[model samples]
Target: MNYAPENSESAAAAVSAIRQMIETGKLPADGRLPTERELAAELGCGRRTVRRVLDTLEAEGLIWRKQGKGTFAGQPPDPTGALAAEIAPDADPLVVMEARVCIEPALAELCALRATGEDVQRLRKLAQRASHPMDADTAELWDGALHRAIARIAGNRVMLTAFALLDEVRMGADWQEQRHRARTPETMALYETQHRKIVDAIERRDGAAAFDAMRAHLEALSDNLRTSIRTLDE
Candidate 1:
């Protein structure tokens, strides 16, 4: 069916159509989707738009891609075993952020206690990349990766799973839009400073300091998001 979505509405409508198909079982579990070219043709949109929709769906765990195989419908591997199964797919972004505030500080503390020398170095590199991100999207991408790397350093499977699920929700289009709207060069610089502090605390093996730094960073991020939301509303 040629959808022919309007120019302004195309991206969102394309995503919605694919999601509805998946939800209604028109696209069965493990079912492979058409190629990007085919989807663009079928939806009457550009290949770039379809690709973005696919990227978003894949990030949200609604689909998975195999190398040279194709994109298929379903959840990816559960790193936390069955524990990750408890995470709701449609979790609210605010709630996800609140959960991150509760969880990430402790993870940062644990990372301080457990991080190997190499792990610390890896974090330093990630932080440096995030600090000088080429764009808002790149900044968010590296920002998420930096946090996930800290979680990995913490070396706890259950917590890792929780972090992964939260990261997935954070990658949703809505959260991405909110973050993009909230970000400014000034705010990014502030975040870079905060990120540096967190890494510094972790590298020094100061668990308490790491915890506090992470908490402060998240709290500042929450405030920034709120201000942005208000600005967008106005």
Candidate 2:
């Protein structure tokens, strides 16, 4: 329970030691580290410095602090999954997905850098699970949910927020109607399969494969969007 801060007045080593604790077996995966007070006492450093390092870890999703509970470890989240409940009236559906293609590729690379076993497992669950096969109203929610999962894995809040905003645009009534009308059993099956592949590649830690898989999926989406664009409300 000791995180002895360097009394040496070096800011860098304190941060490095924190990283070492996590990287080493001292702080195992999903295991709770000592309290900030304990760490400060142990490290012989100021509480503020310890808190700062912990703050950085939280931002990276390497750790999570519960409001009433203690801090615990966390896996990285996908950065590109869109999770908005509603799309704006004037939002451009294809452009939203297109923007993902631009940002998510790099996010995937970062995911490759930072992703952990737990993160991979979550992505696997999302990718493998069958989407609800139902009417347009129901299907839209499922569709958005899966897309949002992809964003969640990126482990970057800025990226997640951007994707969420775009998802809002995608969730608009006009876009949903176009997507709903275009939803054939064949298309649904195809999307589900492609989504699975993307997750699989990410899980495998194959950066190129993951990127290509994602690209292919977006290509399919782009086609659908183009064909459905004219049908949306003006």
Task: Write down the lDDT of every candidate, Cα atoms only.
Answer: 0.85, 0.68
Error of 1 at 176 (Å): 1.3
Q: Report how far residue 225 has shifted in candidate 1, in Å.
A: 0.4
lDDT at position 33, candidate 2: 79
What local lDDT does model 1 show for residue 64?
89
lDDT of 1 by residue, 1-234 (tens): 334444647889999988987788876455878888888888878877887899999999998888898888887655544443455455655677788899999999999999989999999999999989888888888998999999999999989877876776666436678878888888888999999999999999999999999999998888888888788889
lDDT of 2 by residue, 1-234 (tens): 435644545445666776777778587455777888887776667777788878888898788787876777665434333334333433466667787677666666556555688887776665555455457666666556656766777779888788666765555435566667667788788888887787777778877777787778778877877766655544
TM-score of 1: 0.64
lDDT of 2 at 140: 63
Residue pairs clashing in model 1 are none
